[model samples]
Target: MAESIIEQIRALEVLDSRGNPTVRVFVTLEDGTKASASVPSGASTGEHEAVELRDGDASRYGGKGVRKACANVNDIIAPELVGLDASEQAMIDRLMIELDATDNKSRLGANAILGVSMAVAKAAAQSRCDDLYRYVGGSEARRIPVPCMNILNGGEHADNSVDIQEFMAVPLGAPAFSEGLRYVAETFHTLKKILEKRGLATSVGDEGGFAPDLGSNEEAIELILEAIEKSGYEPGVDIAIALDSAATSFATDTIGLYDLKWSGAGRMRSDDLIEMAERWVEKYPIVLWEDPLGEEDWEGFVKFTKALGEKIEVVGDDLFVTNTKFIRRGIETGAANASLIKLNQIGTVTETVDAVRLCIENGWRAFLSHRSGETCDTFLADFAVAMGSGHLKTGSASRSERLAKYNRLLEIEDALDGNALYYWK
Candidate 1:
């Protein structure tokens, strides 16, 4: 019999219990085969609404732009996917061009494109009885431990109403995942109460560490190290500690004044950043340091990465948008030992998968992640585990939304034969 013609495309709109909308897309094949993709619209902090993009702007949206693009993908591009071949990634990519050739579709475009890519890949993976990560080339036998988030309690980024530099104890080696989560919740609650008692906001800060004014970056680093030690995880061995400076270390004021905003500490001086990094390497068992310098400081990154070696795992999230071009740059400059993989960063399951492949093939590690402005989708946990990322970083075991990812991973383990040996305590 002749092959059936590709038939239909459909988009499903999903809203969180909070009523925030997310879009999912699916395409059908001639033989009744189907493929699908989806992404959640992440949250925003400090009045910066996450930007969404569409057909024309997928090429340029980076950082917060990616999240906005994801929203647009769900709202616009998903509907266009109806009545298309489930396997036609090339055709779809072409259609992306035709639909928004002006590339005006900012971050929203990347999100939409990525959503469709993920759905299509998932459908294909389902047909093979394999997980998405495994289908995309990640090994299934290993599961790396997830990292604990260090939240900013108060300081410069704080609305200035409170004493911010507080840290909580996360019982990392709890025998059960749920128990660990509970411990985290209890600890965070206690920390919050303490912050409140001191007239400080409990959940505010830049990069969730170091208040804007408590001291210099060196002082912030000392506090973080002390906090990690107190959190009860063995610094380097048990659950590894990591930093997410959020590009806060690399900003220049509007008129070219450097670092005037980071509590007058100014932008991170490359030498000072290197010094802090070296200190973390010794004082604390820091395994990961993300966005340590500004995105444009390629030379600084190269210098740090070359100096740190395997003593630490330098990761790039803002520096690369999970695109081949950025990955290639990292590879060329030796800027980092690992890369943060966020599907929405480049907008497609295939593209993101390709990025991971590039990393793994080139000896770089993968650290799949979640957005700070986030929802409760837990698919990423499964993806991270299945893909064999060196590790995952969602959030501390505090909010239900944050813990949901860890909970989902536990559930997946239960479904399997008590497997999931990669995580401990």
Candidate 2:
């Protein structure tokens, strides 16, 4: 058998769903098998994540152009990666990281490196004539994750009055990924109707969730539950709620204080935030709460987890940033019971998998996530199933970019021929 050496690697600058420039890479194997992958950018990004290189030209896309990242791939990375075995995923990723020689992949650009990394995996999978999931995760990668559908958006994701970042509906009772998506879609439409009837604006946010100016965060949760009930589902039994505070967006220099400029509820302390979260948990069927505290507030994380982590999932997004070192620290300090896994956060498929493994090994849950600024790439759908992650957050049931992931999951479920295991089942 001849080795599947990389024949050519090329990259291009593309526009994402948010109209921002991103990097896309194309890879070809020795035998002519080809594949391509694109990288997503995040709006509510963590401070410690791998750097996403962007062109600083203010005239083009407001300094968000990724032409420089694309140049890095075409000029610097392609030369080193060509002629290497495409099937050696870890070695390929490590070589890219070493070539950059930066702690956060700044020299070669994480966007550039991740584009090549993902493209190589896809090419290798194509060479083997296997699905991306099976190629990346092996035979046991048959479990489909439940959708954490973001029904409403606020904070940086939207220009709404609601302080919470994301108000989600989790279809935990569906037996298959397709059915789960259907349920969530129905609920999303129902929510839209409720907002329309109330004379609220039905515009969407960066992640395709409804961006309505509801009076309070509690009102947003109430509307979602109402929509769930109207869509013919029981609140706690058939569907559950999830919240992504993205609290770092509202953080201040004060250790335990937050400045909610748009929330209308100003200057809330850590205790106040915990109390509010506790009330929400008691009143609603919220199974997950992500980034309730600012990323640097470890003391608040410990307190919040001790208070509600036993009954609900306390997830760390900005806190861990999908980095293994931060994950280990979070595990040791008992900061959270779950971690949000974003491939762009760590900049490679191998490192993303390592983060998921670390979370599982430490008895923590891993929730695969999508960025607010995303592309049509459905890699996360296959990755979620491949890694056996029980939870996935890919915006709402609207927008083509968000729907692309759900549609891919539907295709994967069909391909499984009833052998796929859903999260609820």
Candidate 3:
């Protein structure tokens, strides 16, 4: 019985490229039968402005320093798990912690180690004939509609200062992969044609010689609404719009000016944020919003959540950071109605699962998400559904990097008799 697990562990990390490096480790049973397992360096955030917040360096590896920190895990920790027991996941996880102990580095904080943990979990699931979501106990699966977050600055038809910081759009939750693909592609194509007719590229940033002027929030919203109506997603059913302001409201000099580093500006004023919330709800009909204010502004969030609980779901990404303390505080204070689950944010599969469970137990909506600066890993799709994430935020299914995750979810559904996921009660 354990031999099956051993073989599964051995098969981890079966894929790699210049952009990604993969490693396969077989956890051996006492009889020497190895479980197939493998680990691959997952996606990295590429050149994106949102990354500038961590430092001008692009890529998840660059801005957040995960690149430098996880680089060590590839060089060190991965080797320690070869020929280990995939079934004895606790042991493998223990090794990760022990390896990290040699130095004071946080095991989960190390991207390379976190990558290895993800691969390990994937293999472990295979041994059990379970998908990642099932393994994580996310039973009730629902495809929450996704909203588009347009990152544009003024130029051409758009302005340079992130014109419509966030927009709403949802992919049709088709029952078939081909249907989903065709729907998404045709929709984008049609959108391009219409925008072209209006002398616009239907783009967010500068492309070729044309740059879009996207500075005003009002203009941004109008363009987004127009795009939604044009794309035929308006009054969409079984779909919801999501938003990630990414602290732009505070990042601007006009409000909440603080010299504190990225980690410090958590406190936000209530009266101001509430006003913004009221204004946004009135204009956008947005169902999901992330990091609406500074992370530490607990009081402000409490007020906003109380006021907007029925109309929209206020989500916390930066606020939770995959840490239980922040999540507990949010729940206790009624600061947010949902939380975004990012594996790298906390650093390990077990920890990530724990966070999702905590969210479920607390009656908070769990949204599995990807970093803006992301690679082509498609694992989160399954994790989101299996973990009972009501929704997911990968990217527009257009970019291969983003599509990789979305497509993976479709594949999982295909394998499940077209009902591979169910919502958690």
Question: Against the hidden true structure, what lDDT does model 3 obtain?
Answer: 0.53
Ranking by TM-score: 2, 3, 1
Per-residue lDDT of 216-262 in model 2, one digit per residue for the tens? Answer: 88999999999999999999888999999999999998877998777
| lDDT (tens digit, per residue) of candidate 1 on 159-260 | 432222223233445554445555444444444454466554454443243233454444544444444445554434433445665443235532112253
Instruction: Indicate the residue-level lDDT of 177 in model 1.
Output: 46
Q: Pick the candidate with the highest TM-score.
A: 2
What TM-score does each of the candidates earn?
0.72, 0.99, 0.72
| Per-model CA lDDT versus the true structure | 0.56, 0.92, 0.53
Give one digit per residue, the lDDT tens place, for model 3 in 1-425: 55433332222223232233233333344344323322322222111111111122555433433343334444566456655656565666668767776332343333545556666666666666666666655455534223232222231113344422344344435444445444444444554565577775445431111123433445545554555566665534422345565553344443443221222324444576578678877766567777666555666677778888778878876677766767888888898988877776665677677888898898887777765445566667767766756566655535466667766766666666655433211
Considering summed lDDT, which 10 consecutive residues are worst modelled in model 2? 1-10
What's the number of clashes in each of the models? Answer: 37, 0, 57
User: How well does candidate 3 match the true structure in TM-score terms?
Assistant: 0.72
Query: What shift in Å separates residue 150 of candidate 3 from its native position after superposition?
Result: 6.8
Best by lDDT: 2
